[model samples]
Target chain A: MDAPTEHLPNVAEALARAVDTRASRERDLLGELEALGAERERLRVAILSLEAQRAALDPIEAEVRAELTSLDDGAHEVLFNSLIAQRAAVAARAELVAEAARAQRDAARETTDNIDALLVEYRQFRDVIEPTLPDLPATYRSVLKAHHDGVVSRLRQFFSRVGADPVPLDAPALDLDVVIGVDGDGAEAVGVTIAIPVSGDVRAATLEGAPELELTLAARVVQAIYEGLDAIGQPTAVTAFGDHRGLLVVEVEVEPTDRADLVDQLLGIMEDVLGTSAELLAAGVRVRALEVPADHLFPPEESSDTLEDAS
Target chain B: MSEVAPEELIVVPLAVAAERLQIDPFEFMRLLVMMGEVPATLQISEALIDRVRAAAGIELWWAEDVLLPTDASPSRAIVRAALRQLLERGFVGARATRIDNLWRGRPEDEALLRRAVSLLHREGMVGMSRSRAGVVVSVSPAAVPQLDAAVRGESMPAALAALA
Candidate 1:
């Protein structure tokens, strides 16, 4: 079990390297501890000095009372009265200093507590972000875009199935507008807007004493659209507008980007709406088309016929 | 001593009932005449009947044939005609011979009449009473005195005037 002489230098080198690394870390830790200890000691000394000064006020007030009792002549009494006033001022100032010191100590303790809590939170945040940090920017953007696209595609599918024919074949039948932005944490944020064009027969009934059938039909169509959107399980903010003619404009906004299968889910919703539409038509609600406007796919600023402004 | 229960009755005004049936008061009186087993009648003064015969230059035996002042009032005339017909038909009784200002019809027609009377009551044109027997329809007590005064050929009473 004699020492392997050939491996001695390598062992020694390894030992020296471990010692050097340990020593460097120890020095850094010791430096930080020393700085913290110095700060604590300085605060302790300050508080102690204030306490001593406050304690001295009692003895000083006793001496003032002794001096007041010794005063016999009127002039001496006046001077002793002035001395008492000065003593009272000093006592008041000492009380103020003690209060300030106590406040500082409490603040320091609160700061220390906050720092401990913040350190835990910071570690958790780092753990969460560390693995994704390298590819976060690109991945975030792509995910945001995919979510926006999914919503738009689902909405388009929904409109295609529900909307009447003469559906614009080459262009987007409905407007699917998305706004993408970077958040404070560099995560991509997205907003989606879909505009659906609603058209129906606005012709006034020629029969005398007939009710306002067009307006009634428009209201029914808008209600059906709202119900259909709700049934589809998509969180959309819907707004409806009537042009006073036969056209109703419905704008739906999908703000949340969490659902990945938004389009497919909406197509499933259309199946339910088709049954509802058949019943509605039988009830004399004659809405011909509830399609998305072809031009709405482009940015709202570029489109001349923005349903948002029309509403 | 036994405690007597308060009488509850459903009464509709004749005018109100006529309006509900979409008919004139005279036409309503005729329908009542047709429906009743015993027709309503009013007593005529023999002196008045005789005076009408003399004015018409009719023989004393033909006094009954002469048109009486009852002819001027369709309400009074219909009651007389119905009573005469009932007498000729051999229905003899004081109740059968007398006509009431209020008209009541067959029991089978009660439901239809009650609905019509209820409509008039809802309109505040008549008062009603309901009993175990059935509904009793009549003009409001406030208007009864006025109707009596009209039947007597006198000015409406002060109490009824105040109501008006």
Candidate 2:
């Protein structure tokens, strides 16, 4: 009794019991776990049902939120359409205003252009242009155009006899474009112009298309005009020569005390020329006088055809 | 002595040489001219002048100094002076300008010189080569003997016959 020989005192049975107890506890725990799982499953199913409900209501709530955030029927969009139509109308009016502005600008430009033209013309007037003109009065000297022909020598003699001291051309042999005025001091004259058709052709130096003898007669006609200037003695004549289109032109200046007597003097001179240059007229040399003033200023009319017929 | 003939030789006027030597050309030429006719051609060269200068046994019969006549007209005096210049400078030839300027201190003197030169030219004493600028006056080679004789105080029929 004191010490039992077998030490295995019901340990298997106790282990079996403990095992049964643990199995029972395990079964209970399993059952409780199953219960908890069922409860969790029910909770998950309820949560899914609530989630389904929330999913079902989300679109309606979203519709309400959107309704609060924005307008219904979009009246402001109608306002945008109206603004677009108003923009079109403003553009058309601006186009019309722009057209008017362009027209006004064009008109202003034309007016300015005319004003500028008038200013230029005014600047070109004699009052403005006269100061710049040379103070050199006409001289009783000959202004030879280029090279005068040999007839110039004879003409020079004739001019000298008629009180026209013709200045000699320095290089009469040159064929230049220069019109040389040679003066032996005190040759300048403040007198009236007596333009001479010094040359029948424009070329004085070459006497183009003019015979020497014919040229002699033409120059003599110029000399014959002075016979009628009986009282205008000792008046120096300044001779200027030029070439018009196919015609020789010369201008001379003479002084007269009375401008009123110029018409009579010119008429007398014309008569004298017509009488004196009868040979020239007979030779069919168109000895018509032009650029002569009648009283104030005479027009260059072609009336001297009678002289040719008379000849 | 030159092998070159007188014509081939460079002809320098005796006046040029006399002007260089500052001696009477006519007077010295007399020393060279012999009794014969003046050679048809004479060479005027530096060698000949040197020889003439160095030569010995040469008789030069030149005019002695004499007084100008109290009654000597200006033209006559000009003629005498031209002759003297001709002799003194051996001036056998000169441009007319030179003869003209020679006595042309005054206008009258120039006229006188021109008249004298013309007189000499007309007398056949001088030959002239006319040009646009002026005439050239040269002593006639044939007249050299007579000019020399006149220089030696011989009576000449020319206007300047009494040159000496």
**Which 10 consecutive residues of model 2 chain B have the lowest summed lDDT?**
B34-43
Summarize candidate 2's per-residue lDDT along A1-76 as a digit string, tens digits. 5776775659789989999999999999999999999999999999999999999999999999987875444432
- Superposed by TM-score, candidate 2 places the C-alpha of residue A183 at a distance from the truth, in angstroms, of 23
Error of 2 at B148 (Å): 43
- Runs in model 2 deviating more than 4 A are A1-191, A194-209, A228-231, A285-311, B1-164
Q: What is the lDDT of residue A16 in candidate 1?
A: 97
lDDT of 1 at B62: 14
Q: Rate the local accuracy (lDDT) of all candidates.
A: 0.35, 0.40
Off by over 4 Å in 1: A1-225, A228-246, A258-260, A283-311, B1-164
The local distance difference test score of model 2 is 0.40
lDDT, residue A70, candidate 1: 60
- Per-candidate TM-scores read 0.19, 0.20
lDDT tens readout by residue for model 2, B1-164? 23432222323334444333333333224324321112222224544554554441122222244333332354554455455555555546552223433443333455555666676678888766532222345576666777666444454436653332
Tell me the lDDT of model 2 at A287.
36
lDDT of 1 by residue, A167-209 (tens): 1122212121111111122122222232222232221221121
